[model samples]
Target: MLVTERTLAREIAPAVERSLPGVEVLAVEMLSPSRFCVYVDHPEGVDHALCARVTQLLDDYRASYTIDVSSPGVERPLRKPAHFRAAVGQEVQIRTATPLAGKKRFRGAVVAADERHLRLAAGDEAVDIPYEAIVRGNLIDEGQVQP
Candidate 1:
């Protein structure tokens, strides 16, 4: 059986932790059948050396897939409850799998997040969106949206 993305992440996480303590693996994205992207972050920030080291350490998987290690950057993707929690009080953009309140897309400041849902304050409205309903979510920098 082919190794799934979650399995790959699980297998490589230990190595990353051993090599760079406090560096967290934020997300693993399969860009294509043969390409993968790994996002990593540290409190001190991620640099070229750290990314290169991560790429080198994951060499065992290189035969089947090309991996690119990267930092989360300014507009980081939010995939889990932990990620959402970190973005609380920050501007965010979310797209749901199905429409909620007559819309599938929402842009606002994240007011709170729990295991099941996140509350976003959009203007005078407060929208509560379930985690299961979210298709994509990312931090939105100031001035990125226009009135």
Candidate 2:
């Protein structure tokens, strides 16, 4: 089976969270065949020490891939229901795997989110996007910085 960022994120997130309380793994991305980025967030905020610790926790991947542990920065990724739940009332950009209503991308403030879906106030209409359909989703900072 081909290893993907999403699969790796799901597999690695739980382990990371178990080891580091309050640290959430937001997303994982394959930068190249031998390199990858692990976006992590902590309630106390991420610092060099936290990043280094996460890097150490994931040392096993170093044999095959160069892991870059990072703070989510201004634009944090949204993957699981908890991520979206915390994003309520915040602007976001969501791209769906399948087009909904002639559109694949939606940008708006998240109004509500549940286990299976989230409601987005895009333009004049509110859109309901299923969690499984989200190909990519991230916070839209709009010139504002966040922890």
lDDT (Cα atoms) of all candidates against the true structure: 0.85, 0.88
TM-score of candidate 1 on Cα atoms, chains taken together:
0.77
How high is the lDDT of residue 18 in model 1? 86
Where does candidate 1 have its weakest 10-residue lDDT segment? 1-10
> Where does candidate 1 clash, by residue pair?
none
Could you tell me every candidate's TM-score relative to the true structure?
0.77, 0.86
* Model 1 misplaced regions, further than 4 Å: 1-15, 97-104
Give the number of the best model, judged by TM-score.
2
Task: Candidate 2: list runs displaced more than 4 Å.
Answer: 1-3, 144-147
